[model samples]
Target: MEISARNSIKGTVKKIVHGSVNTEIILEVASGVELVSIITKSSAENLGLVEGKQAYAVIKSSDVMLAVE
Candidate 1:
């Protein structure tokens, strides 16, 4: 499939936390770096994301905020 998002990282599924409606997916993009994303539980189930599974993190955001203390 074609996507406009340029930031696509190949990562492995580290963990999956399922909530009532939304599910949190933790993907290890790099050796020690991880990216987290929240999607609908139905989507998660449709993808069949399990621990140690290989997946890609497609980042297509309009705005990103960062804070430092």
Candidate 2:
């Protein structure tokens, strides 16, 4: 499929947290680096996102923020 997003990182599904409205997906892109994305439950189900599955984090954004504690 064709997509407009330029950032596409391949990763494995580490964990999935299902909420009442949305689902939190944690993807391990590298040995220590990980990315988290929150998507609708229906969308997640449609994509068949589960642990140990391979997926891509398709990022289509203009800005990304970083924080420090």
Give me the candidate number with maximum lDDT.
2
Query: Per-residue lDDT tens digits of candidate 1, residues 1-69?
Result: 578899899999999999999999999988999999999999999999999999999988899999999
Candidate 2, which ten residues in sequence have the lowest lDDT sum?
A: 1-10
TM-score, model 2 to reference: 0.89
Worst 10 residues of 1 by lDDT: 1-10
16-67 per-residue lDDT for model 2 (tens digits): 9999999999999999899999999999999999999999999988888999
Candidate 2 scores a C-alpha RMSD against the true structure in Å of 1.4
Regions more than 4 Å wrong, model 2: 66-69
As a TM-score, model 1 comes out at: 0.88
Task: Give the C-alpha miss distance for residue 36 in model 2, angstroms.
Answer: 0.2
